[model samples]
Target chain A: MEFEIEKIAQLSRLSLKPEELKKLRKDIESILGYIKTLGDLKTGDIEPTSHVLDLENVFRKDDVTRINIRDEVISRAPCVEGPFFKVPKVVDKE
Target chain B: MEKQLYELTLKEAIDVAKAEGPWEIIRAVIDRTALLNPRLNAFVRFEPEHFLKKSRKSEDFKGVLSGAPLSVKDNICIHGCETTCASKILRGHVPPYDATVIRKLGDAGAFFLGQCNMDEFAFGSSCETSAYGAVKNPWDIERVPGGSSGGSAVAVAADMTIAALGSDTGGSIRQPAALCGVVGLKPTYGRVSRYGLIAFGSSFDQIGPITKTVEDSAILMNLISGFDPHDSTSVNQTVPDYTKALARNVKGLRIGLPKEYFVEGIDPEVETKVREAANVLKQLGAQIKTISLPHTAYAVAVYYIVAVAEASSNLGRFDGVQYGLRAPGKNLLEMYFETRNQGFGEEAKRRILLGNFVLSAGYYEAYYRKGQKVRTLIRKDFEEAFKEVDLILTPTSPTPAFKINEKISDPLAMYLSDIFTIPANLVGIPAMSLPCGFTEKGLPIGVQLMAKPFDEEGIFRAAFALEQEIRIYKRKPKL
Candidate 1:
């Protein structure tokens, strides 16, 4: 029925101040308590629904065509100037 | 002529607006919106000038919807227009390109009336979670129209627009349609292109129509059904003329009433409406038979695990570094945390957390994998049932629309709103909600029709027939 800011922030990959965490704990619990109904069902023989109807292996050819938007795509990339894909440092080697 | 468009199907109303100028009709919608939207909260934004100009020259212009007013749920991207998805995170974020559906609708001559409100990021069942504000029902201003497509449904119900398009994942389209007393069809998974729709659950997400009648919905669906290479998941199939298939003849076709669907917990009124719809099918010469979909009970549970798991991964892209608004902070990690912490609403954060836990290294097998396996069993249940019948029947939700504040405080209550409708999304089949009946309090009840994958024709034929037989088709929302 209750949650801690530290635990939820870790689960959600978010960071918050002590006060913010205190607020988040109540909010997360309020939301989690609401989502918890799925746990009460006797899902035993019942199959869970992943896709409404079944769609299996819809295939497409592996043929490669022109990188159609070569110019437009490269031109629009945010912080890029030349023919390279530039991205902010996302991960650091531990 | 200005009385109400809610009383007419989109086709008839469009024809009338075409023969006559759309000025009168559009004005009437605007007027009603003024009187009604104060309580309904159906629209997130409006551009009366653009809509009027298009309607005046409707005949001179060309497209299937020619000046037929339509609202887009906040998520569907429109070039130079906001696609907020009722979330503050995307507040003021406008897409540079039109979602494929937006382009199609625009090309087809449909008037884009502006965005409709919804649950934040399309994450909640009731419209209450929206950052803008919760949308109240047209039928009863205090009650919700159901969501995440609540505003779209409310617009159609309140006559703010003739028809609207909404995205459905786990009954977002159909549940709201049921609550608002309209028709909503979530086509087979790949039936409509998902090119520019904001994702919640990519595998289950689909754009569907919310309209006054089955035939009108068919016309709209036909225009949007063809494959778009832009969306890798869009199916390339021959787009059938759905309207032509509605000949009021579904005689001798097998109709399956899954016992699991009719079990306890469904409100008595909802059960009555669904049962009465079954009787109508029988009278029309279809053989009604009871069938067992043993896995029905697990639908909501499995849906949450898999949907949240996908949601967590899908939502990961919303980090501060990528796009949209961000809170300035020292260091990259602070930037990411601050942006997301301030950006996402309560429900979205909860899902991301739950998704993280379920999809984490240790618990992935028990929650995500097991949910998938159970999903397969549910699919098999539908498969076995389909062999014995052409269609399955059930109530769209456990009850008619609940009050706005009633379930918004409890996320579990909101998820349960999807219990009756999620099974079809899980199996990837076409399902629709047809206005079946109303409760004593005058709220709408929706009867659902589900058919096998790629067999949308059966669904259309059934809903079209039911629309004709259901006496409530002529009734308009009291708003």
Candidate 2:
């Protein structure tokens, strides 16, 4: 039951300390070990159930019915600058 | 000699409000909450003045639930109020708009008392993972209130609020309600709108009521269950007046006791109480039969894989973005990693990592896809069984409320606590947990009643019948 805890954490965009990574590896292994029982079930040719109800694409009249809450939404951001969300620079400076 | 206003059931409080006015009822609950909340830790946020303002405005709204004091799980957005999902990542993230259920509750005149505590991102069976703190079971403060909706259940059980709303994505509602000795209903998937609920397991989540009695559950369901254009998945079916389903008769109704649920590893008392509940229903003219949901053994495994996969994807939006917590870093990816790493609790991190692992490229077919396929088998098992029985019965939890720190370290053990309740969420059916009896140590035990998808009416009728016969609702915790 080998698991790449660091790789998974990196994929999940989560930083983990060495000790935390060690613990998580053991925990995920046992959890995955238990989850391995699913492999025994003969689900061959069975259609996957993503949603229980037969969901069709829901459409509505193409009319503007939503109220604009721009300020209200922007007010909740951790870093806001005049109605816009401020984030760390994505590109490196030359 | 009369009951305190805070101690009255939702129906009784409503009746009293008809003559006495709604303010007095609100005050009683406010006072009760102020007095008991220090010990219970049920509410993550309880501001007396905030409730007073809502109650004042509620005076003019003459809706069906005029002036009812309710506690909401922290995950559901309340517009202008912090909706954190009990996770630190979203600590200050107030929503710009109300969740559809909040709007519905407001229109019906139900005012919120405060946000209740829960497992961070509704990840654990024990409410221990909440960022605010663990919600102590009203029955025994040392024991955990069943989780994700633990605080909601505690508030109802302890009379902190008349009734509260909780979201169930694998028994977040019913399991806690059972451990706390109250009524918890997880309505059919898409039966209740999930418009404002912070996503955990999208396909499985449904917000329902936790209340002191079955009738209160019915009353709350009527107000909240409906089609919502806001939530695309919300079913467009006609919502029934669930209050009409509380007729005190289970005459000739067939109830199935799934043989798989009654197996070993269940607490002897829980098994006995559930069986006793079945007999009580049988005595009242319902036909009782033994049935099997053969795929039951794989439910917990399938649920963790499928639910966490959905949860991992749904949670990706919280990466130092438009709202919630942001971490400083030289690079954007570093900020994303730092924010999530610092923000999520241990349980939340574990689930997120597992979720990504299963959905990762090579392992997708092995874990996530297999889980989805096996989930179909679990659903088909119920579909076949429902043809023979009107409702399925089982213990809501394997045992009574456990000590606070008992299984928090053991994630697998904690996951198994939801074994019986997980199948209902996996199958997307309506199920309710009602107080059936108590263990010798005075801890509450719950028996579950599950009905076919969209048939909450059947569950109500049968549960109401059992509740009336047992009169367990009359027994309150001596907190």
Candidate 3:
């Protein structure tokens, strides 16, 4: 039941303060114990439902107008300057 | 305590206020919202003038929610409006078009209230991750409202908005709705269109209602509960007017109690309250039966794996190149790296990284595929249980609302809050939470109702039955 806050943080990609880590560990361990209940099941043949519809292919007739963005045909660049979508540089390197 | 404006149900207020012309309801809501914003922080964005203008433009003028105010969860896109999903990555990202559901609501003459706050990227179980401040519970300002849809729940509970449309990922909608003592519905996946809902694990996401009463939830459900041609995932099946079904009654409907859900961690008073609701249902003529969802224990782990894996893939669009907020750098990779680094909240980054880690080349089979396999088992559990009964009933969460700092420290604990609600999403079944009863301490408790696939009507009927008996519709938070 030792929740590794650093390990979970590393796994989760959080930059946490030194103060927050101690509290996070205890909370996560209880939660992990709770979620661990899933390990007890014997589920081999059940077909998982990723989507409600078992059917595939939402084919539409070619005549139907579905978002004909101007960029599809008229794409050189809307605001390309020197091989980039130009904007002022943000996020200065510290 | 004496008929707090914060506690008044929208219908009761409607009687008192008399009529809703000139956005009277919205004005009263704004005054209340302004009062609660400092403590509750429910609304992420509120624009009075723009919202009032839209409020006055209701075409039908006599439609179900006409003049009745509604808030959109920040994740759903509104044309010419910001939908950041409480994520910095999409900060200032205004959608070019309205979500199909939004269009339907607009056509039905519902007033537009501001976008409410949520967990960043719809990733958390509590309202702690928004770029804006976390939303607090109306019952207790220091506690977390269960989230990704937490703000939607808070708004409805606090009487800031009559109803809200929130997207459920895992248990985003129902969990918070349970926490805040409101009715939240997660319709069967594909029952509602995902066209305008910003993606967070697309297969598992759905948009539904958070409301003060079962009736409000039903009315809002009728408005947004249709298929859209724009989304391939939207079912081609006809969407029924759910409000009609609310009056059908749940008498003789079989209510199944899964043995596994009742065994552990669930608060005793929550159990008492849930049992109380079950007893009331029994008194009202529904048969209460003990049923087995033998594989029920594995919901959270399986859900986390699939959800994070899908999230990792779905969230890949946030690189610095094409759309949304970007932190520029010399080259694409640096720009991509920097933007994501500064943009996403800690929890969102955690899930994305977990998603990436789970979907990582070597681990995919063990975590992702195995999780999907377990997901099948969880769905099988529900399917089997449903055969023995018409609907399943359970406590919406193992515990009542928790203090703000209670679970923020642990990602796993936050994920656990969605335990009861996740299996419904995994199975693509319709589930809802209604205010069943409260603890002696007065914290609200919620009871969940789940129906077999495409049986949202059964869900409404069942909830309406309990909603009448539980009768918390009249209760208000003291905030």
Candidate 4:
């Protein structure tokens, strides 16, 4: 029942206002309370099922197939510079 | 008669297109959509001029569904069209290429009608969570069409399009289809390629059809079901001609009625109608038996844990640098925080938070791993029951659609609505919802049919037979 809503939101890369944090805390508490029902059934020996089918190591031939959608993909970005997506400066200036 | 062309099912429209060409049908559907969309809010983006222009050139196109108008859920990619998943963050993100299903539909000459609205990030069971606004149920405008795929079901129910494609991750397709009195199928997980579906619980998501008739669903399954090398999870199993499965014969078929699903808390009317559907199948020479999926009680809990954990990982891509909305910030980390905080709706944020909490360091072993292990048990329950029956029957939703704001504020109540439908998604099996009957207030009820993994043909065989016997699909809402 004790959820650190601010910490979770921060981990999720989401900024939450104070009121929003309050509401999210209440909702997450109730949802987690419901989710706690899974503890009743013991799954001691069962293997976890990540994917239903037993498909592994699905490697395609390394041959290159030309799909030229550079402009189309780049055009959707919110900020774009010539042939590259523009982003905020990450490194600190010396 | 031409004015009612929008009412034609996908098969009927295909035949009409062959004789009269695709223009008349296209124009009829466009006119119908224009008239109905304003009231229903089913379409987020409808382009009459675009469809008309395409219809003009479709005269030379030929295929099984040649020139049939198709409505796509906003979550599915269409090369140049905005695929937003009905959320603010993805509002203007247009994909550079089509989803594999979209490509197949295009090759089959199915002209796009437009994108239908959905719950933001396919999160809510009621359509109220859609950022565009809630889609009103055509059955009763005050009520909600069930969520996530609500717009697709509404579009098909109101005859705004011949057929629509909807992705089901925990009953997104079937729940809405049931509420709207249309047929919806969630194919076996790997039966259809997931190359272009915007991921929401990657293991649970599967794109399928919502249509007026079971036969139309079969036609779409034929076109969209296949292995795509692009999606490694798509099974290499051979895709059968599903239309051939619509033989209307359930004689000697084994149908199991799960005792857990028929218990208390279900609307009496929904329970009765689903039981009646089982009897109808029984009378048609099929054997009906009582079955137990004992782990059913824990399906919702397990689904919430596993699905959200996967979704949180999949949704990590939505930072400001790429597609969609960008919020201003001084630093790179601040940019991500601002963008996500602004982009996500309340429900999306709640789910994302829950996802992060469950997968966070100390909680990982208890929540995520435990949920996955229980998921194995749920799958085993179905595997054991399939040994007794070819298909399992249950109610698609606990009740017919509720009032618009009824469960919007209460997230737990909304999650419980999908209790019967979630197990199929959890187990990666094929399941469907078809119109069964109506309530006293005229709301439609649907009965669910679930089959073993890769046994969609069995589902079609039983559903097509019940559909023929009951004829519930003939009833339509006066929108």
Candidate 5:
């Protein structure tokens, strides 16, 4: 199958130069060529192991113990207004 | 004072700090780091003043790692310090809170030396991919230090720090440790908490120790391994005093030699030394048997798909919205594209792209699903093997440190470096790399020992026994 480099980069929120994409295409092809070997393995009836641990549904008591690092966190924003992280507007004005 | 402190192990340093003082020792490490970091590039960022202030109160503290300096991998957050993950994305960013491990280490009185360099977002096997520039191996400056924990390993190897913390998501810790000729342990997947570590592949990621000796790895393991309410994956199992597991008797211990690890691509010297190490274990009364982990060949392929799939999701948070580098853009989507494009290194982009492709529509079943199913087969290989043997031993890396740029262009070759170490991460087992021998060229080689889940004691016992039988730990690379 042909790998769609541009589409994948767009989906991944990355913008690569044409030259860089050309090089990456070759590398990705090589990597996927190797990865395709997994298809040859007989994995029938094998349960997909997403996580190794058996622990599940971990719960913690609801409490007002959260640390107030809001100011500290907002301070790291590239652009901030008061305690808010400023970002470009998502909606277009009609 | 520097020479004396450099010679002492983590255990010995604590004793000396208690008897004498920690000021001189702390200053010596800082001085050594200052002296060597220029050449080794082992650190991404260091705060000498902050370290000096902390060391002043070191004498009054009473913890097992008291006053011993530890260089942390750049990915682990340390409050008020740069946690760049050796990438441009986190440029000018300082974490507001410490990782759970950092807090634990501080509570234990371990002094923070600085932030060590690593593969950008822990993406590469060699440190070459780091935005901070490649960290040179202390053994041979011309060769690349195995990474993404390369800086941490180099720091310990060069005596720039007593020990360092490195996260392993597919051999980041063990590979570098082996290449640097230090003892590195990747504890059981859930053994160490992952609360503060910058996530690479959350399922496989673990924070482990890179130290000068096997006992030092145990010492650091005791301090870090435990259940954290903050991390859901962290097991509630009783954390054992790992130091007690350092008993040298491996008698009656069944060790398995996986035939697949000693394949054609493995360096002859590494194979010879590891075989000698297995023999040494046999002479020490442990039973050695040839074993087959048939699915081992599929590990690297499976790991890349699974790791990148998870990484793509994990790294999606770095979209220039909350913190980290933000490129100017007319809209939010453009901003994310620009920021990531300018922020991430080449390898990080490649992995993110590939990860997204695997999880993309029409391809998920063929790639991601198949990868996870084969991941089960890989895990089952260990499960079946562990039922018959107490531990599995193999060469930590196929070869010693390769010359810088030797395999940088070929990502596949770089991925192959982790062939022996990746399986343990896949299975969630505890594994370690300790010095076994060196090549005739003086480059260090290490043998890997893996144990069943939460059986850190088993791996520690076997490693300690082999460590005692082999005196290779005494040899230091002359910087």
Candidate 6:
């Protein structure tokens, strides 16, 4: 059971050291190997349960009741410029 | 006098507070936290001022939990207080608003004791994954208090707090309660609102109580379990006064012992004690019968897939641009890489990667989808078994609390410890761990009682019956 370890880590937004990647590679392989046994069970026609309570499409009144703590929320951000959260540039400047 | 105060259960403590005033109870809890926290490492940060101020103003208050100093697991948000899920990624993230549970606790007049320690992001079965350091079991400082609720359980067991709240994804509350010798209840999923709980496995996580007795757990449950407009998944069922369910005779109750739970890996002492607990329940008028939850064998495998899949998606909120720790890097991608690399611990990284792998393009159908299908079978197993039994009894853990680093390097072995407890979370039912007996080394063992969804009363009635007969509450760790 082999995998593209670096690819998965990149997708996960994690940067692993070389040694850490080596260890994770082994762990993932073993865990995936164990999970393979689940294929033996006959789950034909059985629906998957995503949420236990089976709640669906709940809607509430959309009245814009005043925002109570706009300042407090922005104040807790790691980096904020004025009233908005500051972030790195999403697009590279040409 | 301090020793006597420390020994008081939540109900007993409430009575004392009523007679002498709330300040007396607050001072006793603070004194105990000061003396025991350094050695036990049960708390990451304590807001003594918050508790003190609350107690001072609570002079005229006479609510259900008034004067009780309750510690909370770090994952639950408190306004203006840091709510790091014991992860470096969330080093200084303070929530602007209070979690629904915090608001309810406040309304009930329970004082905020402090932020207790836990596994980072509630990742590990043992509490060793916390960035703050492992919480040592009060019974034996060398052993781990079972976690991610380790600190919460330790605080209650060591008398540092009257009661504490912990989140259960898979046995976080009960396993630690078992290891530390206390009562831990995981209310049915959606029975307690999860609006502010830091999501581990969103479908599996529920915040519940770790306390000194079943009645105290019932009292806390009444306060915490209710429908919240803030949480969509919160059920609309009417919440019962759980204390009223206690002490009802179990004479006609039907108890099922799933053969799958009493398998080879279980410690002999744990098996004997749990079996003996069954016999005691039988003598009290309950009939014991062997039952089969055939799908039990697949629980752990299915849990990891579903939990890690949800966790991967849930943990994505922690990238560099948000409230947690940020790392300096040349570009946006590098910043996300470096920040998460530095912020998350080894176990957190492992799960994130595993989660992404299973949910990734090619593997999604086989791993994540099939795992969900298998989960249905596991839930169906419980649905079928409940027809023949009123409750299911099993060992909370296969063995007692092990030494701190025993299974840290072995993830599979560590995952196996939660085998019995995980099924309850998967099936969305109420279950609890009660101190049943002890090991030769004097470590406490717990027996698990599980009932159908919303039937927490069944669990309490049987646990209270056995607890009355065994008198396990009289014993305490020498700590």
Best by DockQ: 4
Put down candidate 1 lDDT per residue, A1-94, tens digits, no spaces.
Answer: 3344466567676776676566546655654444454455445665444554345766777888864545543443333447654444556668
**TM-score for each predicted model, relative to the true structure:** 0.88, 0.98, 0.88, 0.98, 0.98, 0.98
TM-score of chain B of each: 0.96, 0.98, 0.95, 0.98, 0.98, 0.98
**Judged by TM-score relative to the true structure, which candidate is superior, 1 or 5?**
5
lDDT (tens digit, per residue) of candidate 2 on B286-353: 99999999999999999999999999999999998888889898888999999999999999889999
**Residue range A1-94, candidate 6, lDDT tens digits:** 4479999999999889999999989888888888888988988888898878887887778878776787888878777899887777768888
lDDT of each: 0.80, 0.91, 0.77, 0.92, 0.90, 0.90
DockQ of each: 0.28, 0.85, 0.24, 0.87, 0.85, 0.76
DockQ winner, 3 or 5: 5
Cα lDDT tens digits, model 4, B1-479, are: 34488889999999988777777888888898999999999999997566556444764447877788899999999877888999999978988888999999888888888999899989989889988999999999999999789999999999999999999999999999999999999999998999989999998999999999999999999999989998999998899999999998999899999999988899999999999999999999999999999999999998889899888888899997889999998989999999999999999888889998999999999999999899899889999999999999999999999999999988989999999999999999999999999999999999999999999999999999999999988888997
Model 6 C-alpha lDDT per residue in residues B64-169, reported as the tens digit of each score: 8766778899999988888999999999898888899988987887878899999999998889999999999998999999988999999999999899999999
Interface RMSD, one decimal, each candidate: 4.4, 0.9, 5.6, 0.9, 1.0, 1.2
- Cα deviation of B64, candidate 4, in Å: 1.2
Question: Model 1, which residues run further than 4 Å from truth?
Answer: A1-8, A16-94, B1-7, B50-60
Residue range with the least summed lDDT across 10 consecutive positions in model 6 chain A: A61-70
lDDT of 6 at B478: 86
lDDT of 1 by residue, B176-202 (tens): 999989999999999999988999998
